[model samples]
Target: MHILNIGILAHVDAGKTSLTERLLFETGVIDRLGSVDEGSTQTDSGEIERRRGITIRTAVASFTLGDLRVNLVDTPGHADFVAEVERALGVLDGAVLVLSAVEGVQPHTRVLMKTLRRLRLPTLIFVNKIDRAGARERELLADIRRRLAPSCVPVNTVTGIGGRAAVTRPVGSTQEAAEILAERDDGLLELLVEGGTPSADLVRAALAGQCGDGVTYPVLFGSAITGQGVPELLDGIGTLLPAVSRSALPDEPARGAVFAIERGPSGEKVAYLRLRAGVLRVRETVVFHRGQNATYDGRLTALSVAGAPAQREAVTGDIVRVWGVPEIRVGDHLGGPGPAGQAHFTPPGLETVVRPRVPGQEPRLHAALLALAEQDPLIGTRTLAGGDTSVLLYGEVQKEVIGETLARDFGVEADFEPSRPVYFERPAGTGEAVEEIQRHGRNTFMATVGLRVDPAPPGSGVDYRREVDLGSLPPAFHRAIEDSVHLALREGPHGRPVTDVVVTLTRTGYSAPESVAADFRGRTPVVLARALRRAGTIVYEPCHRFEAEVPLETFGAVTASLAGAGAELRDTRRRDDTWVLAGEIPAAAVHEVELRLPGLSHGEGVWWSEAAGDRAVRQSTATR
Candidate 1:
């Protein structure tokens, strides 16, 4: 059977979870429809998720579509959990971008569509909430074309919109669909220009081909609450999206990625693996590649293919949950390397320290936070100079969720300190340092290390190289030095990660019998730190590119508000009664601006912002 892995994505409160429930009911996967407000949805099983009525994690469910088995991945729509969506995107064959007909295109919706197009994943747009008051069709489509994508074609028509009797009917071969296709196909455009109408079959073939190529997007109208136009949307999913079918050979090696990690009832790690090729069997050992030079091997103690029990083996295109790989992490490649699945989103720019409220539960709180980090790696945790632990966050909601989860799941109450912006240190100049093997008191270890630090272009991260010969020391010793270099750089002189720099091993010396890997690991950091201090470092604060649309009358107030938040305006334009302002702002001030925008414009303001890398901190305002 063909396997189709698709993700349901949208901005928060766009009825993404409700749509998932409706699809399950319409497909006969469930006997009764589950309500999000009633906390009965299958995808949102967590207590906090049910109470909050928001999806905080990606949920997996499957339904059969003819001969194809559809693995539907329902991802969180809230911007705080975008990392979950990013992980889900790596394993999907296609996606459904859901938007509310009332709210139209939102900030997060634009971000998701940009990423989907960047990955070239075939996508279908679902205009949900058609039965709600103030729902729109033609105007919303126009907004989508202007902001999201121009190739979006409505494949269905809505009637009695914005009322209880709202419904949609599938339309055959529309002129807009033909025109959208003609732009991409020269032959088709010539036929249309010559006054010849293409046959319905010809138009469909072109549409399917372009949609599969991720150029043309088909839009469908639906109301998940009332089940209006759901069947038509389901048909669009199976017909317009692509699926993969592969037969794995007996001797072929396994190739897949771990997109998510969950803890079972017994506290054992359960890894969600999407098999791209080859076969995986029970009790078979597999190698997980984390990066270029790190690998971990573990045997599969148990396996379940597509949530089916009694399945001993899994093949290509199957999403299986495997046990016994405790070291496995999200984004780890299983068996052998194929695509690296690079991160599509930025890391959290804000961090806060958390302390156990009861004082004696420090260890428990630390252990629980580590487990949470294992599940969502982007919520990175680190121990501060004090005993408190700090966690990275996208927004305040995630921080709240973490505190609640610790109390509920781990039975540990925690208090979070006010959040602060996470910063980075970049090398300001070139410098070198050397420590001879037991020659000086500073070099206590039996290994000598020499290193140089130089700045690279922004966003290049850390690059490690060797100026010394490969045979200068044993391979294990060299590996130890390289690993130590990366680990030590995690905290620089300013207590921030050092990035955009190159480190070279200038010299190496080790005794044949006395020198060990431990000696190199112990000595490398000291030398590298000295070199970094000599090179000096500059601090940079994360920034975001923002776009704000405000009522024309409130332009002065909005601009003043943005300026007060340290925003640098780039352009300003007038759109009817609204003014659009585009520029960059400090990530630290993003939340403040978002909160004040509505009040500044009397609830007529719209805002959108995305990570725009980092900028050098002004010397006058630099703080640790």
Candidate 2:
């Protein structure tokens, strides 16, 4: 049998979970359908998830279709949980992007579609909720084409839309389908130009091939609640999408990635691993690679592949859960190296300090936050000078969920301060510093180091280079210098994370027998810090690009609110009976603006924003 890993993605309330249930029921994987409102869906089993009716983590389930075994991954639709969606994207073969027929193209939907196209992942568009009031077809399709993609072709036609009796049927080969295919196929274009019609079989083959190549997308309309057009969707999944064949050589080494981490009932860590090659067996010790130049060996005590009988071994293309690797993290590679995981979206730009309401719970709260960070590394946690714990955040909803999770899972109640924007520091000028080995008895260390700091372009991050000969010191000593430089830069002269700078090792000297890696590690930070201080630093605040839609009557009040929140209006236009405002706003004020928008617009306003990088702040206004 073939294997295919597909992810279902959308904005919140687009019926993504509902669609998952419908797919499971249609495939006969479950005895009956489960509802998200009732919190009985198989994927959302967490107490917090059930209570909120939102997916905080990516969930995996399996079902069979003909000779194919589909490992369906259901990802959270909320923007705050976009980190989950980003991680799942690394392991998927294809994706189904769900859009609400009523909402048309939303902000998050546009973001997801942009990412899918960037990754060149084969995708299918499902315009769901067709049975709901105000649902649209022709107009929505035009909007999708204008905003999302132009290559999207409808494979089926919907009938009785916007009613409980809405349904869909396959629309055989049509002019649009032919034209879409011909856009990328020379043979098809030539046939069309010659007035020769291609057979339905030929057109279908061309469509499938192009779709798998990520050049064309097939759009299908359906109602996950009513099961309308669901059978057609099933057929599309089995026929239109590609199935991967993992036929690795018998001698091939194991290669896989850990996309998720979950704790067992007994609190042991369980890793969700997707093998791309070779085999992983029980009791076998495997090397796990975390980031660059870090590896740990752990034995697999148990293994279970999805949609298959219990076995001692799992092979390529298997989504298996393995035990005994407690040190594993999301995005870690197993066995050998593969493509480095890319960040599909900007990380959280705001952070909030969390304090235990109950005295003496600080220790437990820290530990629990650590565990949560392990699961979603993007929610970075740090300790402040006063011993408070702060966590990076995406929005207010995530903040609430974290509080709820801590109370329910760790038995600790906490209060979070108003979130503040996380800032960064950049080098202001070039500077050099040196720590010599036993020079005038001024240095105690046996190793000598010289570092130079220079400003780099924005968004370049930190770059480390060496101007000294590699033979001047052992490789271990060089590694120590590089690692310590990064660690020291974490707290720059102004106490903010430093970025967009180049640090170069300009000088090196070491005693033949007395020099050690520890000596270099201990001395390198001191030299780097001196260079940074001499260079000075400038602070920058993160910003977000925002779009606001408000009724014509409320436009004046909404604009006033935006101006009061430190926003810069870049464009303003009228869309029918509403006005659209587009601009950039400081990240710290985003939540406040969102809160005030509904009231200002009389509950008829919609707002969306995404990270727009950072801008320099005046020294007087910079947060220390």
> Of the candidates shown, which would achieve the greatest TM-score relative to the real structure?
2
Can you give the TM-score per candidate against the true fold? 0.94, 0.96
Candidate 1, 30-114: lDDT as tens digits: 9898888999998999999999999998889988888888889999988778899989998999999999999899878999999
Clashing pairs in 2: none
The lDDT for every candidate, in the order shown, is 0.89, 0.90
Tens-place lDDT per residue, model 2, 12-50, is 989999999999998899989998889999999898888
Q: Which sections of candidate 2 miss by over 4 Å?
A: 428-431, 441-443, 454-460, 469-471, 474-476, 512-519, 533-536
TM-score of 2: 0.96
How well does candidate 2 score on lDDT at residue 576? 95
- Consecutive 10-residue window with the lowest summed lDDT within model 2: 335-344
